[model samples]
Target: MLQAKVAVVTGAGSGIGAAIARLFAVEGAKVVLGDLAEGGAAFAAELADDGFEVMFQRVDVTDEADVAALMQATVARFGRIDILVANAGIPERKSPIHQLDLDDWRRVIDVDLTGVALCNKFAVGAMLATGGGAIVNMASILAHVGQENSNAYSAAKAGVVNLTRSVALTYARQGVRANCVSPGYVDTPLLAQLPAAVRQAMLLRQPIGRLARPDEIAQVVAFLASERASIITGACINADGGYTAI
Candidate 1:
């Protein structure tokens, strides 16, 4: 359904971002993958070997220049950007209102909140040139609920929730659509890095008794970006495994 469309996915080195990129390519989108880590390049190479149209760039989501180049490079290579999956984000462990380190708080906010802002800033301009496009921002289940020692992460994602709504309203008449996907803990490398106890707690949050698979989250992203979701905008889809419902 995304045939001929160009999609840019941030943090595509691995995990949920990578899953989104791979799925988009399978749906016929020319994919632009970006990550601060080297994994993005390697993943793109793997896709190239498989005959998928893809490009990779090492990008710092917090950097305006990096994001601008991503947009520029995408248009340079694929002519236009029709889809943007702003999936790059970081979660901080110390988020207690009193004990949270100021620096860590800033870093989380910069990457999680500011990063999405930059992607939208540039992507919106590019999309405007083409009349409009679809944007899917990666939020977290934490955005809606609170957790001990998760203040920074929670605050930033809460910002994403409102930010997405604002952007949706801003571009509604311009043919642009903005939506958010909030996924609970997923079985990704990132989750594996968490303390065993923390990981277990994460699994228990969902009534399903297991973490989500990255590909499952990607499926929802694909639908929202496709024509099927043409009427959906400014909505937040909880991709969590019934975590939010409880």
Candidate 2:
């Protein structure tokens, strides 16, 4: 569905980002996988061995220079960018707002919120040059609701939702479409790192009594990036398995 497209997926080494990259590749997009983790190169290599058009780059989303380089590399390799998934983010430790560590808060904001800003800045520039593109920013259910002891992550994701809207409104005239996908408790490596009790608590909070699969979220992102969604923009679709429905 995305033939001839070049897609850049940040945080593509694992979890939702990795799933998105794989889906894009399966759909015929030349994929550029970016992440701070060392696993990014390995992931790309694995996909390449499978005969997919994929490349990997080590990128620190919190660094403007690194993000700029990532975009530059994508264009250098593929000539033009058609899809950008600003999916890199970090979850801060659970703590009350009043007791939150200042550095932790800043770190979360930098990676989760400012990181999106930087990616959008560079991706939109390329899209405008190419006359159009699609961008899907990864947000969370926390974007629309409060989470106890997750002040930084919740706030940063909330900013991402609004930023997605702002980008959509500003660039639709340029044929650029921007939207957000808000997922709740997706079972990814990150969630695996959490304590069992915490993970169980999150699962129980979902009316469906289960965490979403990573590919399920990927399907939503794929739809948003396809011509099938040509008329959809500035939308924040929920993939929460009914967590937000309650």
Candidate 3:
């Protein structure tokens, strides 16, 4: 559905971000994979080997200049950006609000919330110059339901939801569409670090009887980034396997 479009996906080194990059490329987008991890270059090369148009660029989403350079480089390579997936983020440092280290909170907020803002800031600028485009910010189920000891992540994701709405409203008439996807427990590398029992507990909590696959969430993102969702803006689509339903 994204044939010939230019798309940029942050955090595209692995997990859901990587999945989105792969899918977008397969769907015919000239994809730019931006990540701090070296894996992004290898992954982009892998996609290129498969005959998809792809490129990799290292980015520190928390650094405005780095992010701006990423967007600028994308336009320099692909001419214009048609879609952006703001998916770069760090996991929360588990701690109660009262005991949460201020630095830890800032770290999560910087990468999760502020990173999305930076990506949006430059992506919107690039889109506006090209007559508009679509954006899909990555959020999480924690944005809607509380998670123990994950206060900062929830807050950041919640900020993303509203940030998406704000951008959508502010740029609707300008032709830019913004939306987000909130995913539940997914079988990504991030989840592999948890204890087995914890993983099982999370799996059991999913009404779908299993954790979602990263590609499943990527599918939702891809849909939102395409004209298939042309009328969807400022919306948060849940790909949570009913985690928030109960």
**For this target, which candidate reaches the highest lDDT against the unseen true structure?**
3
lDDT (10s digit) by residue, model 3, range 1-246 = 999999999999999999999999889899999999999999999999998989999999999999999999999998999999999988876777889899989999999999999999999999999999999999999999987878889999999999999999999999999999999998888888777988898988999999899999999999999999999999999999998999
Q: Candidate 1, which segments miss by more than 4 Å at Cα?
A: none
Tens-place lDDT digits, model 1, residues 162-230:
999999999999999999999988988878777898888777677988889999999999999998999
Worst 10 residues of 2 by lDDT: 89-98
Task: Itemize residue pairs with steric clashes in candidate 3.
Answer: none
Candidate 2 stretches with Cα past 4 Å from truth are none
Winner on lDDT (1 vs 2): 2
Predicted candidate 2 versus true structure: per-residue lDDT over 1-246, tens digit per residue: 999799999999999999999999999999999999999899999999999999999999889999999999999999998999999988788887789899999999999999999999999999999899999999999999887788989999999999999999999899999999999999899888888999989977989888899999999999999999999999999999988888
TM-scores for all candidates: the values are: 0.98, 0.98, 0.98
lDDT of 2: 0.94
For residue 29, what is the lDDT in candidate 2? 95
Query: How many clashes (backbone atoms < 3 Å, residues ≥3 apart in a chain or on different chains) does model 1 have?
Result: 0
